[model samples]
Target chain A: MNQTSQPKLWLAQQANRFAPALFFIGLVLLWELICRVGKVPNYILPSPSAIITAFFNVEFSRWMIHLWATLRVALMGFVLSIMIAIPLSIGMMRSQLMNRILYPALIVIQSTPVVAVAPLIIVLLGTDDPSRVLITCLITFFPLVVSTTTGMLETPPEMIELSQSLRAPRYRETWQIRIPYAIPHIFSGLRVSITLAIIGAVVAEFVAAEEGLGYFIQFSTSFFKIPQAFAGLIFLSVISLLLFKSVQWIQAWFFPWSLPKKK
Target chain B: MDQAKNSAYVSMKGVGHQYAPQAPLVVKDIDLDIHRHEFVAVVGPSGCGKSTLLRMVSGLLIPSQGEVSVFNRPVTEPRDDVGIVFQKANLLPWLTVRKNVLFPLKHKYGSYSAADEKRANELLEMAGLTQFADKMPDELSGGMQQRVGIIRALLLNPDILLMDEPFSALDALTREQIGFDLLKIWREHPKTVLFITHSISEAVLLSDRILVMSKRPGTVLDLIEVDLPRPRSSKTINSPRFAELTDLIRGYIYEPDVPA
Candidate 1:
């Protein structure tokens, strides 16, 4: 605020911005040092440099095949869950009977761990894209439904009264007032779901898949190629990070007002 | 007084509402009449059911006993002729100022026409909010948002405007400014206004008559005619008679009705 305070404030902000990156780099250096000093073999734990070498060892076309396999299943499953979750949320909101019937069923499904059921799903639906997508959908579904419903129900009572006073149809209340109010909550759900979608794809590949980063990791570790598996894990994390950032970017591009801090 | 009661445009006779089936009433034995195009302000302490009274007239809530009628017909359901302004601006945050003003029409009819758009722009101009028409509700000051609220209420050309402590959310200076702004707008386009407030001076400053209500089981304690001259300004607030009327209403509020 004051002229004397400006430089100190700027320095504080700079420190805050670079603190995490510096910490991460320092951690990687420490790990690399420990491995070298201890004369640790590459199989037990791959050093950062070895992991980077392993990443380069894989053929470019092979990496793309695995990346596409994981991305396709994750995206399809993510899109499918959104289609089902949003409508189901609206239905539960609009109808007391539907809420009563579907609520307990949804709870039952959500509580059942997808990992526990993955083998059975692959057995029943076969080890194809369909079973894999279903697994991803199950992982991504609950947060979307819960957040969307909570947001719609949380519309201000006075706004609902305003709708009623206008004698507007009940559907308009849902479409105009309730849905827009729910956007921020829904986007938060999307951010969580996008990451979960990637996790879901990996989990599916762990059970039954020929190609994906998850499958690559499993295949590498089995062959005791620990550095290659580490490489696959790192790649998976990078993709998840990109997907999360893309969700945030979509919200900023389309519904800037829905972002709470933007205002 | 009898003739005025008989000719009242909106009247309540023995209106009462119970909290539960056999429980004590929230508001009881309320009898009042509002003439057409007159601004009536109701002031009462907290828990006096001032908002409940407004809701009953809006036909959003029903009275368990007696009746509320507007234009000589019973108010059994929310009417198209009445508009309500809530305590908060209650603007849909996603909509622009222009869209919010036209929300009632779009909400009721599913869409707005070119003519409705013209009316919205004109009203925004009148409220001196034309420049901010394209802006979101959160960008405006509290007072400016509430002015847009009043504009939204007036968009439908409703005959009765029920305002439930509309300026209560604003700071004192902004409240006074918006009160005068409301008066200016009311002069240009008059409607039967039932303004509710916690501020005694605000009631005195804005209304033709002030309805002082009792605490719990809220009944009308006094309906004092303002007797203040029209085109009221800070000069009117400075007048002695204004003090007397506010004092009269204050006396009714403070005089212990139930023995301790």
Candidate 2:
């Protein structure tokens, strides 16, 4: 009886996992039917089918060029933000002076909208790749710094005492005990920052860039090629989702102990 | 003077500590001595700075005034001669039980050797945790986790083992079980142990002497020597002498009319 129920339970679990994807497909089908039945002009709102066709019709090389451009800016900004944020957080955590001096400025920067600052950034850097990357960096930097700093500060008192009692050197304690303890929180920041990096790339491209899916959408929409604009939107969502999942995958691989164990 | 010199493996001379310079002392004028290979348990009411006293002995916290010395060396900072087990076990969640046991060795000896691995395995076997050596801390039950903690402390072969209420978080059955396991381990490999606990019965069952402490601005109220025989078991706790010692320690902890 247990053997028969085991496979049945596994099958039910698999179905449960796929339920959301089935619902999403059903929704898209309903959207396609509405677009057809209402006779909505394709320029106003292309159906899902039209968007897919437009996506495929675009020269694969052209799509690659735009996607590559956006991916480069987003990834560069994300990596730079991580590199800057982690060390800055460590410095901030280590020294009260550094924290007192920089933390208020960070909060001020976070409070000011990136949109308001993007135009200023473009003016300063004059509409170049540097300006675009900088804007993306500025947009994604806050969460990484805040989360990394919080994680470092919140290292368990017991763990700290344990390391101390071990007579662990200062650097060893920071690297082995504190940093490893902070990894989950750091990953949380990375997840948030990766999504924001994509948005930052798009926003920078919308305002200043001559390439990328954001520019593709803006240019296509202005030409009233609504299908192409919708295609670009779909591409952006897929890219963001892929980046987020990659972070999750890396987190799972590096910190498998954090995951629930199989019985 | 010769007897004091021979017996004092650890000595705290009027040690006091406060968080800030002007803050009231959490621990005050604590004078203590533990002889070589003696198992001493410190029991007190809540907020009585038993942990603070243990921290001073381990050199995790430097006392604001006076001195804590181990084997004639004044403890200015954490020394390699001491190992501490905290109340929560505090095993690095990312490390397996064996790696956690080897963590101190990685820092102390710079890197682990094959001999260290062999020793770790032996400690695991002694704790009955050899099967779970590769398992993450969360995989074990609470009692099992604290046993892993005990093995980890024993790994470095420190002269002094400072345990801060290591079994307080376990259920009563597991607590007694681990208590007996600790007794067996201590009997086999004797070290100067300074165990802090709120459980009088646990202190009675484990230690050669139990130091009872007063409430905050904590000081040693009384030191009661347990006349219990070596190789104690669960049955040791059921004895009349165990009851009498626990009752005496309880009186020291509960008597408020005594001046601080």
> Could you give the C-alpha RMSD of every candidate to the true structure, in order shown?
2.8, 3.4
TM-score of the A chain in model 2: 0.93
Using lDDT as the measure, the top candidate is: 1
Worst 10 residues of 1 chain A by lDDT: A254-263
Docking category of candidate 1: high
lDDT of 2 by residue, A8-49 (tens): 999999989999998999999999999999988899889999
For B130-227, candidate 1 gives per-residue lDDT tens digits of 99999999999999999999999999999999999999999999999999999998888988999999889999999999888998989988898988
**lDDT for each residue of candidate 1 in A115-184, tens digit (9 for 90 to 100):** 9999999999999999999999999999999999999999999999999898899999999999999999
Estimated TM-score for each candidate: 0.95, 0.92
Please tell me the TM-score of chain B in candidate 1 relative to the true structure's chain B: 0.95
Candidate 2 regions off by >4 Å? A1-15, A260-263, B1-6, B255-260
What stretches of model 1 exceed 4 Å from their correct place? A1-13, B1-6, B255-260
The positional error of residue A181 in candidate 1, measured at the CA in angstroms, is 0.6
Q: In model 2, how large is the Cα lDDT of residue A133? A: 88
